[model samples]
Target: MKLLETIMQRAQQDPQHIVLPEGNEERTLQAADAILAKKAAKITLIGKPSEIQALANQFQLKHIDQATILDPENYDKMEAYAQLLVELRKNKGMTLEQAQKLVKDPLYIGALMIKSGDADGEVAGARNTTGNVLRPALQIVKTKPGVSVVSGAVLLFTESPYGENGFVMMADLAVTPNPTAQELAEIAVMTGHTARTLGGFEPRIALLSFSTKGSAKHELVDKVVEATRIAKEMAPDMQIDGELQADAALVPSVGASKAPGSDVAGHANVLIMPDIQAGNIGYKLVQRLGNAQAIGPVLQGMGAPINDLSRGCSADDIIQMIAITVNQAISLKHNKDGILH
Candidate 1:
């Protein structure tokens, strides 16, 4: 199957309710059209009704309903939410009108939708900075209980001509520039949970570093070692090990030589990097050079699994991220029951 087909399959199964911020943009409008045409789920678009309608007509796109467009101009409808928005932005020197303008912004609107259960998830950042996309989510939706840091992961998949599938998840690629050991552990645990939830397998995590065990000496290696220990303690039932090199973590023969009798060394599906620099570079290399289909830098460990899109992302990227977000949300709901569902 093509990459888009794989993404569509996941979206169809989950059909996550999604909100599109900045829906007035051409790309955002196109994405909303695609989602609606696919009968994927309910999609709320943030924009002025007339502006959105004009764009839809210009593009000859169907399913462009006025009700689906969330207009910030509807002050009466937005009164309570607008007030909350003002309170949140008061420190930024925003007056009531300015706060209202910001609230109408697609990022802020989408974040509010997620916070209020108006949407299951959101996809944004095509025309916004990473900070712009994440700020509202952090401020309003906040982090999950006991989760102090927000991190991200990419779902890397490789498929052969005959259709065999292989996947590896990498974390801290888009968030946490220089993570402490505890922060790294949080990333590890969060990434592991996401791998299982979205990728459909029990995650075996490898805390990747430049060395296997104590073979190399560096603060980075020490960080991975401590993170691995912390992750194990935090989720005792989780299968995780760390301080392994890339080759050891990914190659069976190399893993056997480097770390004897380890469960996660070669078979690990979730790889928690020592920091963002390595994780970001590693996943992109796999995607651009190794021909793997990279599905995210999907943000995790927030109050919910609200994901941000690459400004370069296609409509298909938004669809896949929504499906992944659905999986994360459902898994979180099930986990809160104190048993796997």
Candidate 2:
């Protein structure tokens, strides 16, 4: 089965509570209704109760009733959520008045829901900007412990069988424009974990560079080589190799000739580009010219599963993101309890 199909199946089997901040938005509402119909997740919609109901009625959505809608202005936990937000941001000199004002916003409410353990995960960004969607999450839910930066990963579904069953995961695609060697190493480790937990495969990670194993000597190549060593140390058991050229990383014949006797050189399923410049250009080239389907810029390395969608996203996109968030939440729970799933 496809990775997405497997994810949806898993989500249905163990449905999680997902909060949708853009409750009255058309695509979000449609996606929420579809999710309820599939029993993929229990949804908490944050918006005005009357407005949500009116939108549901206008769209003739039957499953909207199955979702729990919390009005941003009148939620019972409004004061509690404000208090929590103030506490979280107290060191930043955030006053309770400021927190109360923010709690009225849907995005903040949704994030606070996750922070307060009222929800398992969150999916938003249909009508909001990426920065707007991420602000509350960063302030409240924050990054995972020991993780300092958040990176974005995209799952490239290609026709060529180069990666894991024709699926390759690329990272730092949407966030972290120019990461240092240390941050790059952290991105590598997080993306590997994402592959194992969400992609349902052992990760063979290749940190892409212009040079292949000292064939060329430059500071850029050195950075990649250092990142590779750091990633290996960070995740010693995982398969990771680096300072490899793109051709060496993907093509077996080229890999063997370029980086002899390296495990991940030819068999890498996750490709960590050196910077956002290379990553964004590379994925788009493959997506458009190579005729591959790119599934995400799935936001990883968060304390909880909170994903952002494109403003031009369809209901189907929202549904897919919801499933991705559910799987991430499950994976995070397992890791927290020291259980391998």
Give the best candidate by TM-score. Answer: 2
RMSD of each candidate? 3.4, 1.9
Which portions of model 1 show Cα errors greater than 4 Å? 1-14, 86-101, 159-164, 336-341
Model 1 C-alpha lDDT per residue in residues 1-341, reported as the tens digit of each score:
35346446656666667777777878778777877777665687887888999999999988767237777666344656667777776787667887667665667777776776778777788788789888989977888877888888887886522111477778989989999998898888888777666666688889998889999899878888998999888888788999898888877788899999998877777888888899888888878888988888888878766788888878677766665666666666677311211
Off by over 4 Å in 2: 336-341
Task: Provide the TM-score for each candidate, comma-separated.
Answer: 0.89, 0.97
State candidate 2's TM-score.
Answer: 0.97
Which candidate's lDDT is highest? 2
Name the lDDT value of residue 207 in candidate 1.
Answer: 92
Task: Tell me the lDDT of model 1 at 87.
Answer: 76
> Clashes in model 2: which pairs?
none
Instruction: List model 2 lDDT by residue over 247-316, tens digit each.
Output: 8998899999999999988888999999999999999999999999887788877889889888988999
